[model samples]
Target: MIALKRLQILLPFVGIAVLLAVWSLTVWARIVDPVLLPSPVSTFRAMWIGMTSGKLGVDFLKTVERTIYSTAIAAIIAIPFGILLGSSEKVYRSVEFVIDFFRSTPASAMFPLFLVLFGVGDRTKISVAAFGAALVILFNVAYGVMNARKTRILAARVMGASRLRILWDVMLLESLPQTFVGLRNGVSLALVIVVVAEMFIGSTDGLGQSVFEAQQLFNMPDMYAAIFAAGALGYGLNLLFLTIERRFVHWSGK
Candidate 1:
């Protein structure tokens, strides 16, 4: 059992190792043009230098700021609304169509509308990302509340819990796991939107803009480095939420 657990822990690294090996082999074999597909060493070297001594670091921070801002906005608006909607199944059902409609719409499709509303500035990009993330979070939070164990709710009522009390103490706690799930997913979507928006929405600096500019300039190493940075950022965000969940929502899986 100990060995199996250890192996399971190492499983994630195995794929990473295999991927690096394959990439190195492919580069050495001249399987593709080096200009288009830089070696991992070269890519990582660019990543290091760009992050340490170049504009990439600034761009990375800009992207992080925008993503964080959008997600915060979404959560601020969605959480309370979701809770209110979810506490009453009738209310949630009445507006389910509208919620689903906006959620189903691609955020990108709203670019033109936001552009017209907020112009080609940071406001438009952040608003669009916020809009998209809100729907995702709202849905999850509502579902979380709705799915709260009925037995617990009944028990709370039997113990003389009022609707507000049950919502605050019982339903809210029950919904935490699902809420965190929404937050993680929302942040991810926010990052993606911010990146894409940066590439085309008059961005002066950001990971998205960095990648776009590098590609246009044929700076393959820089482009790959930026791409890797974005990937690392996404992975880091997800891991951060997971850690928080483990810390605060320890009863999540239970």
Candidate 2:
């Protein structure tokens, strides 16, 4: 049992090791052009240097800043609005189609519209990202609240809890898991939108800009480094949210 548990703990690393091996083999065997796909060492070295002593670090931070700002704005707007809608089925139904429609629209497609509205500034990128994220969060939160266990809500009411109290306690608590799910999804989408916007939105410094510049220059190593940095950021953000959920929403899976 102990051995099985230990194996499970280390299981995720197996994929990493296999991927690295395959990558290294491909590079060594010249299966792909070296100019196109750098060795893992070359890629990591570029990543280390760019992050430590070059402009890549600044660009990475800028992307982080934009993603965080957008996600925060999304959560702030969506959470309360979601609660209101969730608490009233009629209100939720009234605008469900509208919410889903906009949510279905690609954020990239909205860039031109937002650029027209806010111009080619940080405002346009951030606001467009926020708009996309807000719909995802709002949809999840409303469903979470609406799906709160009826038994618990009824029990609260039977115990003489006011509507406000039941909402604050029972419904909100029940909604936390799904809310976190929304947050995670929203942040990911926000990051993607921010990166794409940075690439094309007249930005001077950002991971996306770095990637674009590197690709244009045919600097494959540096481009890979930037790509890995962006991936790391997304993974780190998701892990952070998951950790917070595990701490605060301990009963989430149960």
Candidate 3:
């Protein structure tokens, strides 16, 4: 079992190494133009330079800040309302069309509307991200509540628990695992929306802007570096949520 566990840990690293090897080979063989796809060494060098110059740090921080703000806004608005909706079939049915409509709409398609409403400022970018993230979180949270075991709720009622008490003690606990899933997805969507906004919505500074500028200037290495930074940020955020979920939702599958 110990050896099996060690192999499990080593397998991912092996896969990554194989991917890198392929990437390096392609670069070496000039399968693509170096201008379009710089060698991994050049990309690493550019990343190092950006880090040393503090530019990457600033851009990374800006993107991360926007993601956090949007996610917080989404969670604050979605959770309570989602719970309320889930607890009442009438309320859920009444708003189902509205929820489904907005959820189905692509966030990018709403960019122009948000830009007009909030203007081409940070507010517009954050608002767009928050809007998208909120819908995803709301959907997950409501379903989580709705899917709570009937037996558990019946038990609570039989024990003479108030409706509110049952909601808080039984439904809420049952929903936490799915809520965390929503949170993870919501934060990812928030980051994606914010980055896209920064790239095309006239942001002065951000990882997206940095990438856009690098590409416009034909600086492939810097562009790749910025892209890598953005990917790392997303991975880090997801990992964080996964850790939180594991710790708090320990009984999720069981």
Best by lDDT: 2
What are the TM-scores, per candidate, against the unseen true structure? 0.96, 0.96, 0.96
Clashing pairs in 3: none
The local lDDT score (0 to 100) that residue 254 gets in candidate 3 is: 96
Give one digit per residue, the lDDT tens place, for model 1 in 1-254: 99899789888799899999999999999999888999999899999999999999999999999999999999999999999999999999999999999999999999999999999999999999999999999999999999999999999999999999999999999999999999999999999999999999888999999999999999999999999999999999999989999999999988
lDDT of 2 by residue, 109-198 (tens): 999999999998899989999999999999999999999999999999999999999999999999999999999999999999999999
- Residue 140 local lDDT, model 3: 90
Rate residue 70 of model 3 by lDDT: 95
- Candidate 1 regions with alpha-carbon error over 4 angstroms: 1-9
**Per-model C-alpha lDDT, please?**
0.96, 0.96, 0.93
Global Cα RMSD, each model: 1.6, 1.3, 1.5
Query: lDDT of model 2 at residue 159?
Result: 100
Worst ten in a row by lDDT for model 3: 49-58
lDDT of 3 by residue, 1-254 (tens): 99898789787699789878999999999998877888889998999889678588789899999999999999999999999999987889899899999989989999999989999899999999999999999989998999999999999999999999999999999999999989999999999999999999998899989999888999899999999999999999999999999998999989
Tell me which residue pairs clash in candidate 1.
none
- Cα displacement (Å) at residue 8, model 3: 4.1
